[model samples]
Target: MSTVYDCSRPQERKDGLAAAASAVRSGQLVVIPTDTVYGIGSDAFSLSAVHSLLAAKGRGPDMPVGVLVGSWSTIDGLVLSVPYQARQLIEAFWPGDLSIVLRHAPSLAWDLGHTKGTVMVRMPLHPVAIELLRETGPMAVSSANRSGQPPASTVDEAREQLGDSVRVYLDGGPSGDPVPSTIVDLTGDEPILLREGAVSIEAVSEALGGVQVGRPR
Candidate 1:
């Protein structure tokens, strides 16, 4: 059985965050509301937890998972090096809707599956998500839905898809628009646009001082 918390209530919000953090630490899955859509998340450094998250979504490990951080400073410890362009982009759109891919630090002992020594990370703007992340550290999060299904914009929709697989569902109400964060790859010398979602390519270029972003191949 899973617990659903209506975060509109103060007490429930507090309880939910506690339960969700506990679940993550115990290697369980949790559903959280992000700025764009609901996400199914687990402890990023826990290999078993990441596997469970992927299993719940009927997703393959080859696709990999993205990690969500609580703040900008949290990113410094995860990546091998934060390039100048990455810093500029983060300053321009962090805590909003931008995901950046960079080489992961070799010292870390986590497996997100087939990431090829890289990790996609972002800091979401949603309060519930940020609070949970701050308490639990980085989390491997993917859209709250089964494979081949539409992303869940509401907690109800997330529960319908993930069901008992998720230990806790933090309801932050309807996530307007359901647009995903734009993904930029900073592993190479230049920035590459892997996917364009909420943030536009034009906006990204402007943030990087007119540097051309390689279009999605």
Candidate 2:
């Protein structure tokens, strides 16, 4: 059975977060609440763990997993480059709900399920989620639910879908926002808005001095 931790208590929150981080380091999955929604995360560098995460989510290889990082250095280590324009966007709405897809650093060995030499990275604004990410370095995170299922708005909702598949559940109450992160692909010369969610298309375009928004694939 998964150990569900109530983050309402200060001490329990710390202990639970520590255990969650440990789980990620040991190749175990954990359901964490982010600013946008609840996400199931595994160690980004663990190839096997990433595969397990995909299986748990019933996700296919063609669908890439987005990455959650604690800071810019972690982002730099994972991606080929963070363009100045992209950096502007990152600065403008990071730790919130904007995900930027960048060219993956070839030397960094990690599989996020057919990312096609690119990675979608985000810095979420949730305290518990960011704390866990900082402790775990980086994690391959996907919304907490089976593929095509509505995202879990609360920890219990996530627990219902993930259950024993997850080692720990950090309950941070309602996600507050059911909207997913705005995904902007900056791997090419032009920034492409792959999906619009919490961050609007106009905001992204303005941050990059104007860019194209594409229909979701």
Candidate 3:
């Protein structure tokens, strides 16, 4: 059986965070609210949990999952070497709605799918998400919906799609609008805009001192 916790209540929020953290640690999936949309997440280092997350979404390794971190410093440990531009972007738009793709540290023992030695990472601006992430460390997360369906904006919608696949649902109320985080790929020589979302391309360029953002592929 699965559980849903109304995070609006103080006690439920505390309990939900505990349950969600436990679920992640045990290689089970959980749904949590992010600044962008509801996300289904599992322990980033657990291959079985990652497989379950992908299967629940009807997705494949080709469409790799992204990782959500709790703090600004977390990215430093996830990537091979945080580039200067990545640092600038983190300083300018982190804990907001920017997701950056960078080369993962080869020493790490996790697989987020056919990421080709790279990983997309973000630091969300939701307190519940941050609280849960702090307890669980980095998590493999993706939109809480089937591969071709709309992203979930509430825990109810997420539960409807993911069902018993997710062990816990942390309801942080309605997620307002479902704007996705802007994804910028910094794995190449020049920064590339993989997806233009909540954050604008111009803002990204401005943050990097007018460096041209490459067109989406």
**Which predicted model would earn the best lDDT?**
1
Which residue pairs in model 1 clash with each other?
none
lDDT of each: 0.96, 0.88, 0.95
Ranking by lDDT: 1, 3, 2
For candidate 3, the TM-score is 0.99
- Which 10-residue window of candidate 3 scores lowest in summed lDDT? 172-181
Q: Model 3: per-residue lDDT, tens digit, 1-217?
A: 8999999999999999999999999999999999989999999999999999999999999999999999999998999999999999999998989999999999999989999999999999999999999999999999999999999999999999999998999999888899999999999989999999999999999999999999866
Residues 77-135, candidate 1: write the lDDT tens digits: 99999999999999999998999999999999999989999999999999999999999
Better of 1 and 2 by TM-score: 1
lDDT of 3: 0.95
lDDT of 1 at 112: 97
Once fitted onto the true fold, the runs of candidate 1 whose alpha carbons sit more than 4 angstroms away are: none
Per-residue lDDT for 55-155 in model 2, tens only? 99998878979899987668888878778977898789877899989898999889998888999999999889988888999899999998888999999
- Candidate number that wins on lDDT, 1 or 2: 1
The predicted structure with the larger lDDT, 1 or 3, is: 1
Give each model a TM-score.
0.99, 0.96, 0.99
Model 3: colliding residue pairs: none
